[model samples]
Target: MSNIGSNPLIHFAAGATSATIACVSCQPMDLIKTRLQQSKQTKDAEKYSSVAQAARTIIQEDGITGLWRGSTSNVMRVVPGAGLYFLMLQMANRRYRARTGHAMTPLHALLTGSFARAATAVIANPAAVAKSRMESVGVWEYKNGRSAVIDVLKTSYTRGAMIQVLGDVIYSGISFAMVNTTSPFAQKKASPTSQFIVSAVAGAVGTAAAYPLDVVRTRVALSKAQGKDAGIVAVVREMLEEEGIAPLYRGVEFVALRRAITTAVTWSSYRAITAAVGRARR
Candidate 1:
């Protein structure tokens, strides 16, 4: 186990594999969540009134395949991002354990998770911006994932990236603390089922806490894609004044469900892969 933790390749491989699986499984949910967040309700009409409506409209307008509109860009962002995150996490955890002569406490997990996620977000933000735009319900601007990414790279899209990094760092820290706390599962070797359960619980809690930030991030990303520069404060203020508070939680249900599924699958698969690699080396 210690050797596994020390192996950067193992961590990156496990993280990438797990992230690919998790993202593919929840891509449709992600598309819906983006659509819901990007939509606004007026006195007479709404772009997407509900999750079901969003799904139905997407299918009608873009075909059933539309449900996975941004999946390529999402994978481009998350695979390497998740790989780097796990590598950083393992390096941080190993150093912490060495200095303390014990496993990480919740506080340790929180700090390390925040640092790892923040660093990864900086590198992944452009791809993330592309993913959000590709998933948004509007004219399909880019021809492919590469074009979408190139378009984002050509713009000054820093505000949304800052907000996304902040929200993601906090979300990662909370989820890591929740999963690695001094609980029964944390105290002992967690089985795959236990890993899934703990990860699901952590994901749900983190998603709820960070969802408003997510909406803001999505708004800023899409706005930037359209050559608009809106700061976080301005975006939030506009949303509140024009759409009310409910819009901030537009796709909470879909996001919650997707996060739970993604976290559970990612952690369980990561653990299983690392454990297998450890045993193989032994």
Candidate 2:
């Protein structure tokens, strides 16, 4: 409930801290989500069987770094996104309370948070896409089929980063809105032990909702790096033809679990930070 926007430094600091924490805590699940999202079943599905299996496989194959494949992009996207989100939440909460003449409730918090997240997603879509791509498929494919981030970026660049970013912004905004709208209701009805269930559900729903765009973004990013021209429509059609609609929601469970943990951590931390700041100010 602090005026985060009014104090730019504090807002930024809080945002940075929050983003860092959120990314670190959820990176493993994020890796799983990316893998699932990017999974393409050939004649035989040569992919991890489940989320747990995926984690173990990644560890066995690529070491811990594989699990943190997109940590850089995650930091880039999250720091700004989270900063904007927290700042907006404070601003929105204040406005909502002033207009309604009531204190912040869970519903208010949820709506405001969702709106802020959507806004940030719009701005940070390209980065988010880049991060997801970097995490899921790496930057390039070697002759044998594996690539690095830099190589991937160098290959992809047809539409330019700006264009991709714009597309991402739109996709992210819609996705965040969907996730936010349903989260509060899910949480409200959940049992105490299952409070985090809603967060997971929201994450999964959001991932699925945004996944087609995510696939397009990934193809665009990777194709650009590979010097190929694959439009969003073409990519969507290709994915559908090759993998069917189910592929779009492949990594949903991982996304949901990651989201649940991230949300719980974020809210808990934000509350703690706000309280500490309040005590200090007082």
lDDT of 1 at 174: 90
Q: Candidate 2 on 180-256: residue-level lDDT in tens?
A: 45445544664433434444444455445555555456555545434457776766787789767876666655665
**Regions more than 4 Å wrong, model 1:** 1-5, 41-47, 157-159, 182-190, 224-227
TM-score of each: 0.92, 0.70
Best-performing candidate as measured by TM-score: 1
- TM-score of candidate 2 against the unseen true structure: 0.70
lDDT of 2: 0.58
Candidate 2 residues lying further than 4 Å off, grouped into runs, are 1-8, 41-45, 103-115, 138-216, 224-227
Number of the predicted model whose lDDT against the real structure is largest: 1
Q: How many backbone clashes does candidate 1 have?
A: 0
What tens-digit string does per-residue lDDT give for candidate 1 at 124-183?
998998888788765347888878888889874464888889889988999877876733
RMSD of 2: 5.7
